[model samples]
Target: MSPAFSVLMPVYAGDDPSHLEAALRSVVDQSVRPDEIVIVEDGPLTDALSDVLDSYERAQGDHFSRYRLRENVGIGNALRVGVRRCEHELVARMDADDISVPDRFERQLAVFERRPDVDVVGGYIAEFDDDPDDCFACRIVPTNHTSIAARARFRNPMNHITVMARRRAILEAGNYRDFLGMEDYDLWVRMLSNEATFANVPSVLAKARIDRDYGQRGGLSVTKAEVRLQRSFYRSGFIDAPILLYNLLTRASVRLLPKRIRGRLITRYTRTPG
Candidate 1:
């Protein structure tokens, strides 16, 4: 039998109620469903979202759990709390708006079963706008440790929402910390620094939601955060001076482009590499 696991999801006011419902359904109805679903309400939610939670609570009963924060904390902080509260040794991360394929959990767990040395496992994601059936792009990452670590030098090597990690490993690596947009990347770098084993199943495990504006790079604050993250990468020894300078220049130049052109460039960079 598969070991028991928990799914940790963080949702805030910005998440759509309908999308939340779909995400929950995907978890409970998975081909190999998790024994526990831990949802962290990042802040007080809208009545619509609360109502959706109410319905699920009634239907899911003991299998479902909710923890609400008095105020808004970012995903990293919300996950830090939920990770500790989880009862199982294996924890899967999911986004409030994305939909998982039915066998996602089963496939990922199989990786752990086969390779007990792996501390974390992730998979590819297909990006969809209004309809999942019409995924226009996919983000593919390396499937083995050497390639994954090498990819980390320049980019995020795993899709955050499709990750399943050993609870002990995550905690030992200092749990999660708040970062503007690169929290998972930050955590991965620390895990790498600690010599944690990693792998990815070679498949699209989830259909991630996206919008027209998803590709648009943010303003000054976002760029600053990117620069800050690259610096963190440098200090962590994931990248050196030259890689850092190249990343900053390419990122800053792209952010200065017209919105449409920037969006196109970002989307292209996000797709499966040639």
Candidate 2:
């Protein structure tokens, strides 16, 4: 039997209305539908985005729970608030612009049932641009707990949007924090430090939207945040000093690259032919 879980998603004013509708539909259409979807409005949303949410609420009824924040507090805080509102002990993170495969929740639930020690389960993601039907690239990560722990020393081993984790474990690990562009990585580092088990399903169970502006979101500010996270990990003994230095330099270099060059590098290193 599939373990019941709640989907936690944070939406901001900037999200594309059409994408939000598709994302919500994907979750509602899951093979093992979530018990509830706790959506936190980071702040006031555009009329179109609000309309989309209202329509889902009407269609989904009690399965959709919406919360609002008076001001935008960013993704980390938004998710932190949403997590607390989740009714189920198992909480699945879903981005407002991403689409999960029909069996995504079912597969992750099976992992929890088979491996009681596992606190978090994620999977590979197929990245698409303009059309969801045409996914061009896949982002694969380490599949086992050991590999995931090792990979965490250098980079985020889990895809945030593809993760389903125990709510208690997340809260115990200090929950989400404002980590700039690396909130998920920051949480994973803390969770690993606290000995929370992690794994990936080794299959593409989600589709991420990576439009043209995706690569442009990173720059010096994001690089600084990455360096800060690495340093924190090293100090917390999650990563060694050498690994910290290596990440700082490498991440900074990538952030300093020309936008076009960085975009190409990101695509080349992060994605494989789907």
Candidate 1 at 42: error in angstroms? 0.7
lDDT of 1 by residue, 115-178 (tens): 9999999999998888878887888999999999998887789999999999999999999988
Model 1 residue 125 lDDT score: 94
Q: List the residue pairs that clash in candidate 1.
A: none
* Candidate 1 runs further than 4 Å off: 252-258, 272-274
Worst 10 residues of 1 by lDDT: 211-220
lDDT minimum window of 10 residues, candidate 2? 211-220
lDDT of 2 by residue, 153-254 (tens): 777799999999999999999999998868898999899888899999989889999864356346778778777877888788887778878988877668
Q: Could you tell me how far off, in angstroms, the CA of residue 64 lies in candidate 1 after the best superposition?
A: 1.2
State how far residue 61 of model 1 sits from its true place (Å).
Answer: 1.7
Evaluate residue 155 in candidate 1 and report its C-alpha lDDT on the 0 to 100 scale. 76
